[model samples]
Target: MKLAVVGGGSTYTPELIDGFARLRDTLPVEELVLVDPAAERLELVGGLARRIFARQGHGGRIVTTSDLDAGIEGADAVLLQLRVGGQAAREQDETWPLECGCVGQETTGAGGLAKALRTVPVVLDIAERVRRTNPGAWIIDFTNPVGIVTRALLEAGHKAVGLCNVAIGFQRKFAGMLGVAPVDVHLDHVGLNHLTWETGVRLGGPEDENVLPKLLAEHGDAVAADLRMPRDVLDRLGVVPSYYLRYYYAHDEVVREQRTKPSRAAEVAEMERELLKMYGDPELAEKPALLGKRGGAYYSEAAVDLAASLLGAGGSPYQVVNTYNKGTLPFLPDDAVIEVQAAVGKSGPHPLPVPSVDPLYAGLMANVTAYEDLALQAALHGGRDRVFRALLAHPLVGQYAYADALTDQLIAHNREHLAWA
Candidate 1:
């Protein structure tokens, strides 16, 4: 099948390639199209994809293009992974609000809303082009403010599903924290990207009932077992967990400690810069790592892995993403593309409906819904007040009027970026 990766020039392209490479035998990718605005980066990913396929002794057509239309034409699946304004824009997204005495984080709070407002228009353009070019193609979107962009794509009447490695990665990590096999620990995951929580987790066996809360009661052991443990997420879900919780729950405590608060967003930008420098001249670098890793990398085995899984080359269940929750989950407005667990095959992705989230995470769901509504309003209407109301409704901004002031200030300060003052 023809699978096209839009924004294939991104630094994360390698990880995706790595992810798919390991699945090549099952997915048996027939053709791969890498689309991006940067010709050099597109060439890099395309070159990597071709090399990975050959190393595995698989023959697949790999094509790179700057033309979006050319890449989407007759595609069976399209992966959207673009950064509309790049890290520079994200830096602005984070820094601009900080300058106005507001919390500055991309894909959350005021900064995330601003980022969404700016990005949705651009993402929709890509979706529109894909729709016009390949009516049957399913768009696998991985853009930040994913909840916003995915909803916009669906609202604009496009076939698309949002994707994020964060959620599933965290799910598996939490399972590890609980000392259970990842597959055996079934969870009820909900909420928006990055802000989501696992409301329930249980051992898949017969001893399922009450295991999650019992495990959570042993917080000390869980924390010691995994420093990366997201105890806060667990606490929120009222269970044991790992990952973003280390920072998310400690936000207030970290500030009290006078230490550098954990910021994956800042780290993401810095790593991108370092990797771009390394990729600029692989000869000067010791080992190259893409995504969050540093150095010692192969051409990447991920893309092939995905291809293998798609072609049905495995016995175990493969994690392939399919869009679910369009009509089922009322928490998110209809058309918000939610990335959930799915089994992939020749028939494509079949989504798994996780259990409903808790009331705490339900608040986050409400925030994403607000962001989605605001993104749509920003796209279809030019009302800054509407955007303001959305921001006001956000949990982050609920107690911080400064966030609102910052939002207003940002629009005035960066009128060109917001397309209004």
Candidate 2:
């Protein structure tokens, strides 16, 4: 199949290429198209692709182009991996809104709003191209601010899927912490892009049908006690928490008192800076994966899994997916595009009904709704009312003096960006 990797110049590009090559035997790739605006990045990814193709003795055609039109033409699938902005953009996504005393984390607060504003236009432009070029291709989005991007694509009437590994990754960690195998663990989870909660988890098997929650509730304390500082806290969160989630949830009083304080965002930024310094040196860019090691295992396996499902290589069960709510979320507006269980096939993604969300869960969805609406407003209309509405709806922000002050502060600090008076 012909696969297109957008943002081909990204740091993760090599790993993705390595991932595809590793699976070439089972799922041979016939063509790869690399798309990016940066000449240097295109060259970097192209170089890696050549090496992989040579090493694997694969006969696939690798095409590199700066033109979206050329890159997307006749593609069977596309991996949307572009960052709206890189690390610099991420820093802004985290820092700008916080400067105004509003939650400033990327994919959650005002930062996500800004990201959606910038990204929506770019994403729409790509979607338009894809519609004209590869009309039938499955667009796999690995972009950040995923919820918003997916919404934008859906609004524009395109075929797309947002893929996140965090769900399965952290769930497995939680299972390990609880002394159960990953496959045996079952969890009910819901939340916006990065902010999610595990309503409950259980072990599901012939012998363990009723033992899942019991294991967690009974052994949770000891499991929490045994893990290192942050991981232990993550254990108490019910599911193994992601490194990114800790930044937001850890600061909450309940989370902190529970001894699951999150690592600071500033620390994450500094670590990123260090990595940039290392990669700035051309010497390190040429390193190879260790012998016998799978390259880009994190995403490649998922990509292969997606390919298998799309092609019906195996009679795999339908995969759950996130799509427009229609009625998936009874608590929220039917128009809301919720991430719920779904099954995918050649016909594309179909949403599964989400069971009722109780008060606590409903309240969380309400908060997310405001955040999502604010982003949509920013992306579509660039309005202050939309932004204000989002913040006011946040559980963190209330309809009192503090909320007003936060609004004024944000508007005053970033007048250029803030559309609200």
After superposing candidate 2 on the true structure, give the runs of residues whose Cα lies further than 4 Å from its correct spot.
25-27, 56-59, 174-187, 200-211, 214-249, 252-297, 314-320, 353-355, 397-421
When superposed on Cα atoms, how far off is each prediction in RMSD?
4.7, 5.3
Residue 171's lDDT in candidate 1: 48
Residue-level lDDT for 343 in candidate 1? 58
lDDT of 1: 0.61
Model 2 Cα displacement at 342 (Å)? 2.1
Ten consecutive residues with minimal summed lDDT in candidate 1?
A: 294-303
lDDT of 2 by residue, 62-99 (tens): 88999988889988888888866565665655555444
Write one digit per residue (lDDT tens) for candidate 1, span 64-137.
89988888898877877777667666666665555444456667667777777777877888878887888777
Candidate 1 matches the true fold with a TM-score of: 0.78
